[model samples]
Target: MAWVTWRQHRPQLVAAAGLLFALAAAALGTRIPIEAAFHRESLAACLPPAARTGCDIIVPHFEAEFGGLVTSVRVLTVLPVLAGLFVGAPLLARELELGTYRFAWTQGVTRRRWLLSKTALLAAATVIAGAAASAIVMWWRAPYDILEGRISPSSFDIEGLVVPAYALFALVLGVLAGLVFRRTVAAMTATLLAFGATRFLVTEFVRPHFLAPLHRVVLATDSGRGPGDWVLSDTLVDGGGRQITAAREDLAVTHAQLAGIDPHTYIVTLGWKRLIAYQPAGRFWDFQLLEAGLFVGLAALIVLVTVWLVRRTAT
Candidate 1:
């Protein structure tokens, strides 16, 4: 059974290997050095003693070089969906459509065993391929992830890898579609639609709202402050004891008004930056394990459907 399975799906295995190789090559080519961007030793020397300041100098920008590679790994988003359509969509559909299952069924192999063996073999292959793709993406994104605050506990806990469990789910979905529809083309189309809808809903709607809470903050500044309010780059700060809008051109009138309001009296102002904090409401492993389990459970449900349909119709 193992040899037969390998022989039948060798092309997919080769394709998986090729995709992993391409990802690995891209990762190595696009990596940026985080150490140089963040820990500059000469920044103090360039600044005047009076201008010395304390600030959160996260890493220098590395997103430009790594953005393309990050997007490339997102290809995995559609890979499992396509794989299932190509492999699982036709597994039972084509055989039944062409009346070839009759020959195999009469050859002493039970329909249940045949379906189980094929799904088992294909699932294992799909899982391995997906895992390899996820690992490559994880490794390549590690450096920038650290500097960009992306490797935080929350991101790591949520749906991070685009492989293994996700791919398995897609493959099973394809198999179920093929068995239920009993037509390869129809099954493929249905599988693609199902996969696209599931992915879009989960990513765009569900993930962000899962246990996330919202809050609002109010900032009240002194009347003598240069500006009533200001919004700057998240990285910019008044670390040098200067106002937030000290260099901005739009605040000229505001600055002049403030100067007249308090040349003799100094006014201290407060600026508020509203940010959502999604600290894990509980243990980290719980969410990670939950996400993995949910997807895998969906995959198992699809497999059951595939088994049931194959048994009923593939005879």
Candidate 2:
């Protein structure tokens, strides 16, 4: 049965393997020192000759951020999508379409057993593929991450969280789509649409809440009277990268003596900002766990649905 399953799904497996191999090769090739030096080479066109300091951090006059964005898109966005589509879309739909389920059923394999074996096999393969791709991306992007200051935990919280989980979700979603649609083409299309929609919703609407809800802080300094008043604003961890909003602490005013008269200036409060930053007391871990559980639960739910559908399905 296992051999039969492998033979049946060999096309998808081969395609997935080939795609991953190409991605791996491209990633490795791009990691060469020369490749990094040449990334976005067109940016040099905008720089003045004198301004071209050979210092590492020199801005290329064009968008330096574009390279990192492209890398992120390739690693975290494109590959996982292809994995989901190729791995999940045809798990069972092909069987139904080809009328091969009759043969398997007549051969004394229970529908549940058949479904379980295939799901287990495919799910394992999907996870392995995702893991390998992620590891490769992480390794290849390490230098770029350091150069771009993306190693900061805060940045990781946003980009890293969304991509992998979305990949897994997309895989499970493909399975469910295959079971529900029972046609190869329809399953692939539906899986892609549903996957894209859900990913859009989660990343935009739900992700910001994981870290203290996003808010803006208005900051300004005032010089006046006896001393410059440093208002008491929100206290954040120094160098811990937490952003907060609060009133400034009282500050004393100080000035240098002019030729004749001492210059005195005072600052009056104009207004507060349109938004404020505040950390949820301790919801950080809870949010992470919640998101993780949500993805796993969603995957489980889809698997269960697939199982039910398979039992009832003739194939």
Candidate 3:
């Protein structure tokens, strides 16, 4: 079964390897200039808590120069879904679609064993590939991570246990889709759509609440945001402690200009405050584990369902 799995999926395995190598090389190649500029600007002196020391010009300039390249790298999040589309979706679907399952399933091997053998081999491969790609990306992104924050969507999706976990889940989802649809292309399509929707749901609605976000009030001028903090909302409230009305907002700006003061300072003088909701940087790892565990658990359930279906499949 092991040998057969390797022989049948050799092309996919080779493609995955080549893709990973290309990604690693590209990352390393790009890192040279990014790191060089980071040091050239002496931006280390601009690190948080003292970010105001001398960062007024260099930091923004640095980010503006390299921000597009860094942002483009976020598309690597698609790496995990490729496993589902190519490897897992076609695993059983191709055999079943071409009526080769009769020969494959009846070759003295039980369907469950055959399924487990193929699934296990490919599952492990996807997990390793996803993790390797993630580690490489993380290494490349560290300089920017130091400047920005990893909890942001662009960074969070690609830099932790969750990447491998997403790969595993995507693989199983593709396998399940293939088993149900019995057509490689349809299964692949379904896997892509489902995986994308699930990712969107989790990222937008579920992740922020993984642990209750901390809510606090601070002067608008202060911002009170530490480096790496994931601030959800920063709203300006009036002296009456309500969200500032539009007319009042205009008045505040006008008052600030008349008084020759910054709007934030004027707002503070009026006893207005900012209500902030944020997830601290310290919760990064905790959020990673929570999200990873969620996906891994879902994958385990999928494997169980796939096994049950395969066990009752007619040879």
TM-score of 2: 0.65
Please state the error at residue 89 of candidate 1 in Å.
Answer: 1.5
Across 103-215, the per-residue lDDT of candidate 1 in tens digits comes to: 76666768888788888989888887777766766666555444333323323422244457778888888878877788989999998999888867764555444444332
Give Cα-based local distance difference scores for all models. Answer: 0.58, 0.56, 0.89
Candidate 2 RMSD to the real structure: 10.6
What ranges in model 3 sit over 4 Å off? 221-225, 239-241, 244-269
Query: What TM value does model 1 have?
Result: 0.68
Local error of candidate 3 at 233, Å? 2.2
Worst 10 residues of 1 by lDDT: 224-233
Tens digit of lDDT per residue, candidate 3, span 51-144?
4566878878989999999889988889899999999899889988999998888888888889998889998999999889989988998888
Alpha carbon lDDT of residue 196, candidate 3?
Answer: 98
Better of 1 and 2 by TM-score: 1
Worst lDDT window (10 residues) for model 3? 48-57
TM-score of every prediction relative to native: 0.68, 0.65, 0.90
Residue-level lDDT tens digits of model 2 in 40-159: 443233233333455335433222644655445443465566656877777767766787767776667787887778777776777677667656666766544433333222333333
Candidate 3: residue pairs that collide: none
User: Candidate 3: TM-score?
Assistant: 0.90
